[model samples]
Target: MRKSDYRKLGGIVILLVLWWLLAYALNRHFLFPSPFAVGKVMLCQLQNTAFYQAIIMTLSRCVIGFVISYGTALVLALVTGHMKWLRDYLAPLITLLKSVPNISFILLILIWFNREISVMIIVFFVLFPSFYSSFTNGFDAIDQSLREVMILYPQSLWRQIVKVELPLLKPYLAASYESGIGLAFKVGVMAEILGQVPDGIGKKLQWSYLNIEMAEVFAWTIWLIILLVLLEHGLRLLWKKRKE
Candidate 1:
């Protein structure tokens, strides 16, 4: 392994040690379960079908929310990128969406929509501004010289977009996806918990919390961290492969 890998492993080890020490000192299994206890719970959960169902439901919601937000942002950015007046007109609304607290969105959306739809909408609200900003910034940063060259040549609009705009926008889109996917999952789960959706990781967490199953809570949390790390790492690898 590389030196960095070893350092990361060492850090994890230190954290586990600290966690164990704290749990031992507290001597309250229900309040602060040890790593071993949590690990055992995780193992049991892995054997259960419900755990997989919850994961799948949550992942589906996250993906759907991300796709909707990304597509909407891409379309709006493309239109507004060329229309300064429209961009200015939408600026206040974008700022409102970006500035509102996530919990506030969750509460308002819960009132306006059903529980499952509320979760998706909450994810949308949380992610749309960031995606839109990234895309518009990318559009604005595109080289004016290239556009001038295109104008001089007089290519078809589709050709110009395909050959010029999309190529330039790729990095921005990839960056937004990398950053936004995790946030989507987080916000979706939070909405699920607050909305009390029938089945999801958030619902499982709520159930565990209500039952005071601290070990299960810790186990679920560990799974979430692992999934997020795996997802980010997988995306980085895919992006690297695409570049190659």
Candidate 2:
């Protein structure tokens, strides 16, 4: 590693040492577990079959919700982009959805749907507006002169879309995707926690909190952070490849 990388590693070690010292001084497991104890618990949890199941269940819901939101947003953007009148009609409704609190949706969805389904629904609509706005902006940024030329050439819509629209929309699409994934996971997990899904990370988190298992709670929270970081890195790599 480079000197800078080593410096960062040293900084992290220092922070961890401080945290451990603080935990020792506090001497209350309910309040704070030492970093070593947290690490041990985290490792032990990884060996449990339920841990993997929880991860899979949460990931499944998050992935489904993300796909639904992304596709819906794309379709809506296409429709409203091509139809100015429709854009004006739907603008307020989209804005309303965007402005609404995610927790409110979680509670409302729980009332209307099964617990498992509620989390998926919450993630979907919670992320929809962001994707919609990004795509709409991307579509608006399309070059009129190039579009007119394409029209003159009588190119098929698919050709125009693939060659022109996609290139113009690349950045917006990337931004929407990255942002949507993170938001979807967060909101979906929150819904699951509240709705009490039987076998998900969120449910486990709630159980840990209720039982005063502070280490377990921290472990689950750290797991969520790790998932987010990996997903973000994957998206960045994909975007880089696309640019190349």
Candidate 3:
């Protein structure tokens, strides 16, 4: 095997050994199931249709919330960032949203919206301000000197936006997307679990908790972590391609 491959294998082995030791030390399956047991449960769940359906439902909610929040934030940030008065007007609202705890919105959503809509609402509220701030910061980071140079050559707004602003903001946009997407998924799923939305991984997790199926709970958590890793890496790869 190549050295890199060997190093990866060695790291995995070390991790597995540490996991085994921790599980043995804990000696309580309810609190800490062995990795093998969790793996077995994961394998079983992979064969079950319910698992896939739950995953799909959760993904739909997360993706919808993320896209809506991200798009809205991007547009608003662009508009407000260039307008000092608009930025001043928006500052307090953004600060309020960012300061409020996510769970505080849950009760209001549960009362005002259906259980199915609660996840979307909560995720959007939690995600929008962060994305908005990141984007506006990116816009602010653009050097005025460059814009002056472009203006000296009498560049059109479209040309300046395309050749300068977009490229400069690409990294910030990627970072915001990376940060916001996963946070949306996490906060959305938590809302779903708390709201008891049907046909979601959160619902399954809640059921497992009620039934005291610790192994299944661990399995579900493992799947969530796996999904997050895959999503993050996939997004990063796509952004890297665009940058190139």
TM-score of each model, in listed order:
0.94, 0.92, 0.92
Sort every candidate by TM-score, greatest first: 1, 3, 2
> What's the TM for model 2?
0.92
lDDT of 1 at 179: 92
Maximum-lDDT candidate = 1
Taken over the whole model, the C-alpha lDDT of each candidate is 0.91, 0.88, 0.87
State the weakest 10-residue window (summed lDDT) of model 3.
154-163
Off by over 4 Å in 2: 1-11
Candidate that beats the other on TM-score, 1 or 3, i.e. the better one: 1
Q: 3-71, model 3: which lDDT tens digit per residue? A: 998998899899888988999998997778899888899999999999999999999998888889998
Instruction: List all candidate RMSDs to the true structure.
Output: 1.5, 2.0, 2.0
**How displaced is residue 194 in candidate 2, in Å?**
0.8
lDDT of 2 by residue, 1-244 (tens): 9999899899989989999999999999777988888899999998999999999999999999999989898888887876899999989989999899888898999999999888888888898888888899889888789778877887776676777777888888888887788888888788888898889999999999999999998888889889987988898998899889
Error of 2 at 116 (Å): 1.2
lDDT of 3 at 172: 83
Model 1, 139-206: lDDT tens per residue? 99988898889879998877777788988999998899889988998898888888899779999999
